[model samples]
Target chain A: MSREWVPFGALAATVILIQLVTMFTNTQYYLTQLIMAALYSIVVIGLCLLMGYAGQISLGHAGFFAIGGYTAAVGTTLNLLPHRDHVLVRMAERAGLTIQTTNSWGVDILYFSPWITLLAALLLSGVISLLIGIPVLRLRGHYLAMATLGFGAIIYYILLGSRFLGEADGIYDVPGFGLPGGFTFDGARNNRVLSYYFVWALVIGLMVLMHNLVNSRPGRALRAIHGNEPAAMAMGVDTARYKLSLFVLSAVCAALGGVFMAHYNGGMGPTEAGTLKAVRYVAIVAVGGMASLWGTLGASVVLNFLSLRGYFGSLDDAVFGVVLITVMLVAPDGILRRLGMYTLRRNRDTAPDAFPVSAEKQVQRGTA
Target chain B: MSSELIIQYILSGVTSGSVYAIVAIGFNIIYNTTGIINFAQGEFVMLGGMIAISLVPFMPLPMAVALAVVITAAVGALAQIAFIRWLKRPHVLQLIIITIGLSILLREAALHIWDEKVRSLPYFTGTVVTSVRIFGAYVSPQVFWVLGVCGAAVVLLSLFFGRTLIGQAMRACSADPLAATLCGINQKNMVTLSFVISAALGALAGCVVSPITQTHYECGTPLAIKGFTVAIVGGLGNSTGAVAAGLLLGIIEAFSISIMPMAYKDIIAISILLAVLSYRPTGLFVRREVGALKEF
Candidate 1:
């Protein structure tokens, strides 16, 4: 049991194996979607933490997603009349490269590479989230949910109707990355595969970070807050700080997911940030069990896979509804709790001395 | 903008807002009885519109609307008996999610049934008087009908509650369900009635508004959202407040166009709902029922 190589007996080892097998499955588009689903798992995890552990709800998470996707998309777009602002133009003129407005959309629309644009977008998204969270996260439960939902509507409309994008139609044929070391990528859709892998990596990294977070002292504070806000406050826990932290964290995760989604989908649309979509994401976190990180990972995986498991693809929403209702009925604490109970009963009759390897037990002990 | 244009916009806001206000009344009725918001109230409007439009070609317009109301009322009553009432013991989050899910089911079913087409039913008066000069901008007769219906609904509801046994029973449940139960009132049955009445309001709204805005499968969502916004703005469980807030929202939306884009028009209603809920949290009319806020 103590051997270093025997780590194959670990939970991480099992999940990694499952994820690998799922990634390589014969369902070709399934692999891509699995990766996309994994990317979304990152956001849902933070959402579960916010709504579950912190007892706050947000209905406009896609606002962050829009910001993220737009960051990458518009960054890559290289808008007209932007590379040379007045100050930049002056700087350029002094360097002898004469600059003047060559395009008519005014000065703000012009110039930058995709990566630089992405950074700016991410920074802007973070700033916007901080501003939104400061006032709005002050509200609790349904009120907070309504506020965020409105924000989602506002952002979605902005993305859709703004001429900077394609309006309701949205931008098409967005540029893809080309290798600097002599490799060329042709189609943006083809580039989607690469973005999928990038998202996979990003999501996995986030999961590990989130998993670690929820196992920490702050995580205990969050869980206590969720169980009873008054009790948490009575214990001297700074409820507001924890609430704000979770809000920022969740927004960042969603924004990162949006970046991946935008690139893979080859330009984001207004629908990506709609209330219905945000609700769907929240439902994902719920169906997966807001209490367990693994439940989200599993639920998202299972949900995405089941959606394409048949011909209609529309049946997936129905399936989601069923799963959501059933899960709420069967395991209010989440599917992870059910799994823990099953395994624990099995272990009680089998390996009593071995430590329990379930998230329910870990959280219970941490709370203790 | 011209005064006439301003008047036109205001009239338009009031009419649309009137529909929302009616729906908000429905929301209030349900909330008062059960202490929870029903997200599917909007679907009642959708079903009402879909059925009324479908039957208008063959039946008398009044009869068609009457039939739609009755059928939608049954649907609403059945929804309560089948899902909301049958949930045994539901948490706040769980109940909210259930309502949202039911709403999606109703909406998607309507989409599949109606096939995403938009059509208009004939106006109540069947008089098409376009561009009646108001302040300077012309308004439609249908707008007046909207105001009339909402006003009538409020008065009628007031009477129903004050003058009828069932209405008084409903008030008892709102006041204290346990006490009402001790008084030999069937609280569950009252809850069902609340759903029925709310659904009927939503359906009536659909029929009334269909003549002007037209009806589509997704019309229920905007309708539901507007109704919900109105309810939230007025106060979550206040019936009178809903009607008042609905009128206020209509007027606000009308004048909001002067300051913001037309697309940002509904934004004001949604903004008010959110802002009020956040700032006050208790809603504009905070007459919480005795022990009514307790979770199941």
Candidate 2:
């Protein structure tokens, strides 16, 4: 029983320790950074599952992130659906949406709940991921990377061109979410601590959920696919379907991160959709042990903290690029494996089969 | 659109497409020999243009251009020798990521040297004032230079690959590195030579196009994507198909502006890229195999 609860206990302990440290030090700035780290961790965790377990690389995860963020932002700004817009009853509406005015509470309102927007964003992102994954997951290695990259580029440009999405300037005045008992989580100065706890709670919940997923039968199949796809296929694993499922899962995770981030910041921007941001996440995943969730948490906290501190300044991006190269070069198995953690390195070889080349080519190379 | 306007757009498309074709050829040269898409291919182009601009005041334009090409080639060779060749157990993903890192380093280095300002070069044939009237549309004389240089490059490259022993050795390395090694061909040297040639071609493309499009530190990434678009759309390892696809992409891009806003022009390229990849993963000009190292 203790063994089962140990991981969750450690996560809880870490959060409590961080809270204690912040409370004692009275350094709220670090709390701000921690909030951002927690947000980014949500995205990185999904990416790790996709890359480390599913044996796929997506240089376009940022596109999903943008979809989530822009969806929430646009939904609120336009008050798309499930919003009371009693004033503009005769205005234009599309996509079978009807503008019905409502003044049930004696006030005309045109505000969609942040919760509903978040849900819509998640649903939209999942659908988009499924649509994208069907064709793209069939590709292998660098071709898939290029295809995903092209997808990302398309998203970035679409955001930059569309006026309704606010184009390059992006959207602002995004509403914050509310909690029970007359409390609001609006990323305010006073309520920051509350928001931080809320976000970290979600993080811990996700980690626990992912831990279970990665230990299940599906997880075993995913590992098999990553270890050797042809062998997995021979064993009756449906590689394509599994890959697509994981792709959708990763996209949904990124979209969730993006939605919360938009609400937290009260705005969304095209910069979040760039390939550079995706690469940064990839770099962070590498810095953490690629296969270790705890390592990802550790790396995200450290790296995102340093980033928010402006420690690297103009060289922040270059530093991430360097980190990626150094990590991949020096410790392909990851930082955790280097730390002599047997559990962290479980079942995986030190030298990873990073190249998912075709079986025929592998056979030829073996002979040669 | 008027026939004359269509002719003008087609001409401009061909001119810009020639540059994309050159970059695509560079991609093919390295990919064929080493099976690595040097993400820094675009940086080589930038370095060529940047180096030539910096040297033009010190020497004749032609000499500056030639020196830039040589220097960029050396950089490419150095990249292979220093980073790629030194990998202990190199894999495809690692190779690609390292090139991405190299590209970042190169871009930052350029930023430190030239800052964020856009830089342009003088037209190869004449000043910006000089133009030629064709089909009632005024076109830059440098367009002719672009066409002439690209045509010459394609013809010369094909001839060299067909007739030259060194070129044949490079081809041999791509076809079967183990067999080539057995036959006394140094695979390492062939790969290095491929990088040099690719870089030189990229540099030449950069220098010629700088007069029209201008050069800047951030230009490499977009150029690399455009080149990749052409290479993939044409079928990855096929140079002839890359040339044809490059022209087609450019024409599509040129006409797309009429239908959409100028801001959407960039979207058009990547949209087409996504469309092609999804609908026809093997590319429009399909082939059974591509890339030099089939084992990745």
Candidate 3:
């Protein structure tokens, strides 16, 4: 347990060290993208657990993320002032779930508190994931991939088609998330440093939680299911339950990231729910080495930061597409695996003994 | 609705349904031969339309479309040889990702090569406004062209598969690759041939539907999803079932617009896809026992 904390400690130190360097170099503005990257990292690490450990590929994670973002966007932006006389609204107001705020145009409005919106976002994401996962998790391989892809496409079309969702324009001018200490999570220059640290703290906390989860009994069961579902079932492991639960968990993680990122950016777009974004997340996971949580975190931060900073320019999606094809073709296990960076425990977990000899050999061979 | 309105909706639905059927056939050919669903299947259709549109200025319409089919077929064969042929026995996940990547790459290439503007081939026999009265409804002449070409392609494909030695060899490869190899069939070439045929078929359908739907770089993804829905609804490898499913989906979509907003048109097909996946994954037409024998 003590050893398990070491890498996280190193990660924390590195996080602070980067901040300090940026401050000293007067390049603190870079922290803005870093904050966004950290949020994306939350989604990536969760996906690593599902794809790498649980052996389930979800091509619709962006849909969950968008669900969170859109929920937060809609919850806070939809003024309840007009409906304040309604019973539920008055009750909610009495319960202190509603907040009185002013929009960008200085018009007064009653809206749900950011905290309430966050809760709603997470709950909605959890429910949607559960609904999608129940039947979707039953599929295997190509069928699973297509079903999830279809789900993502559905979410995108709905977002694009719904007038209440702002149609193709999406929602903008989303109010900042307010914290207890009067700190607001937004893209304002004055709030940059605080927002950066706040986002990273949340990310680190989630990573620690995930790390603990991955080493626990449920995590072992997940790896067993990944190794051989039939064998795992024969051993009395509830494969379906484990897969479904992990799917929901990962989806909730994605939604949490989406909520915070939408607040940080002060807007959400339909493109956030698009299939390309989902594919991009998968590419980062593939690059990070599916089973290595730390690798996924590192890859997500670096790649997403670069992407957010406009380094790829007009060729952004194209670059990720190339990365996916090249990585899968050249290193199916991932770039980290190619570099021999996986831990001994991971190696042992995925050793030949854990899987059928032929499958294990094919994965290890790595080349046609 | 009036009978004329119903006839109009059915005609429109059949026009789009035939296209979806062709796309589903494209998916089935590769799936049967290799047990891999080529996610880039829709890109072949997009390429056919784009290439034909580009070529129309230099040559006659028929020649341009023929050339486009050949070129797209070559692209299909090249893609198979480059990315898939050498993979000894890739996992399904890897193949899915590779094909997805290929689709994106193809879309991006089309974007750069022909700009982002939507383009379409001229109608085969008449202008866009030219209509034929059929059972009290006015139908575009292009509708007949789409149905006729698609029908002919399906009949020709069935003949090729049932009668030709090479096509029989390909079927044998799908049945049992080891036995086919023992019988001196070149399995690799058969796989490449499957890709070529599917691509050619998709291209033909794309050209026929181009005037009605218009071709855009981003259109392939949606078409792919809709075609996939039809494929699942019809059963994975059943060409005849695909035609029925495609027409059903198309009519549902056509009638759906009367009740729902046009913006939500895509949701109709996708909802059916999810419902079918959850309840009858073996498809509406396939027997449970037969479906159980085939690997998903």
Candidate 4:
């Protein structure tokens, strides 16, 4: 009944509930939506850390996601160094070894292995985040947002124009993650259940990691930065270092999500890098509440599921935009936080000691 | 490069640069009056183009364009009065998110009404592809129209800000909101006026440029990015700097296409943005005091 364990308990219960539903329905369709929601939750949670906690905004997190997806897609399709004198080949030659090459129909033989591609995607996104964040993070508020927005635009336009990355058509037939037991996660047949469980496991793991992160010292530092940067800096926090590291960390999270998403859909498109997609992620975070990790997780689940189901059809972006605006206007702290407040107020006389002090102050500061 | 090619690049760059300048000025108008960066600024340009193209069937070309500008400006003012005016102790992020929402709403509404088809307007003077040869390069008459309108806007904007009492009052409000309020200037009305003027400016740019670039529902975001780049590179809220930065970016993009692929234009523009921001966040021409870094 301790407050700290509430989110973990909720997470376990939700996963169990999903498993039950999947059993009853025995349908891949509903599971597919849930899986995609889990993937987007990964991205939104990182964004929540940066925006909701670290006081940094990224209007271009989709760029990082796109980097991850494109890395997977292109790595499985095209030969980056097509020639014999490539660095990998040269290294292999020097090391007195022959590089392993696989011959597969539809997939490029010279391309890196799927596991290597995933690692590359994650690393590249992290490095790019560091490069972009160093300067952009120096800016505060909307200026930082604009800088990230520019970065996103650059990524999108590059993807749209580059023929090697499949242009606007995007790279298709992305190879799936392979495991030791000959299990392939390509969203096919019985594999759908495997991929669903695999992705959600990662999602739950990330939720636990994020939950612990926000409760630790660094998490408190991030909150302090969000609350008041100068004050945090005066208290001996390395504001710049924390911001940059978290920025890269968030990019890595988005990249991992992108890799899974690419394999899940069998391809990824240039639209993944679009500013609107980034806005969608931000909208999820806003709907969940800025400073509340569990709230963001819930919002991500609901919003991403609605989006994947095409609930709003062509007006999806517009609906999300309205959601972001309305949330910021009516409850800047988030809908969940408001509900928590209402519940606390209703039970204040009956259970005075049970009211969550930190949650109450967080809501107050958000509105203030 | 050949003289002809150089001439072509400069002509095209200047033409697009003028449009960017117009949009950047729109950014400046609102930024100066209220410390909010309105994301819906580009949507006004889009609205101007879409509405003008739609109106061309019912009225004369010039008349349609004029009416479109009026209507778009009215929409801009209405947006402020409807949403911004009602917020209680709204934070900066909240205001920005509202503008973003408005942009999405406007874009989707345009899509639903106009469909996904791209629309074009006739050139102001003629339908013919009449070109004047300069340095053996073919220059379209539309380029001159773009330049002339931009030049006129600069003159008119300067006059308004300098000679008109209302513009001066708006300037005062931007300089110090508290002092301006104490001096009996209505900050709310000035903010609304700034939005109206900026929207009209954006509309004029769209109306003039649509013949060459065409108009569509999705054009707003790109224009927003390019205009924002100009605004940032020139220093936010500085109209002259926005114009200079717009022209500089346009020229750089034109030249960049020669060395790199067409797709790399965006990368190059943003690289320039990042470089400028990292080295001198205030921008190229503006003093450091006017930097967008003041948000902290």
DockQ (C-alpha based) per candidate is: 0.22, 0.44, 0.44, 0.38
Model 4 docking tier (incorrect/acceptable/medium/high): acceptable
Q: In angstroms, how far off is B48's CA in candidate 4?
A: 0.4
Q: Which candidate is the best by TM-score?
A: 3
lDDT of 4 by residue, A1-368 (tens): 77756757767777778877877887557888888888888998899888877867788899999999999887766654455588875674465433234535643345456787898999999999998888888876567777888899989998999877889899987767776588887777678777777888898889789877877788878777776677889999999999998999999999998998898888999999998898888888778777666677888998888888999898888898889878877787778656775354222222111111222111110000
Please, what are the lDDT tens digits per residue for candidate 1 over residues A122-144?
Answer: 67777888877877877654456
TM-score of 3: 0.96
Error of 1 at B140 (Å): 2.7
Give the residue spans of candidate 2 off by over 4 A: A79-109, A342-368, B287-296
* Stronger candidate by TM-score (1 vs 2): 2
Candidate 3 colliding pairs? none
- Expressed as tens digits, the lDDT of each residue in A1-368 for candidate 2 is 74766877878888879888988998766887788888888999998888877878888899999999998888766644443354443242432233233434454345555666788999999999999899888877666777787788788989989999898899987767666776666678888888888899999999988888888888888888988888999999999999999999999999999998888898899989987788888787777766666677788889988987899998887788788778777876667777777355444442234344443342112000
* TM (chain A) per model: 0.75, 0.87, 0.94, 0.86
Error of 1 at A9 (Å): 9.8
Chain B alone, TM-score, model 1: 0.91
What does fnat come to for each candidate?
Answer: 0.10, 0.34, 0.46, 0.40
How close is every model to the real structure, measured as TM-score?
0.85, 0.92, 0.96, 0.92
lDDT of each: 0.69, 0.80, 0.87, 0.81
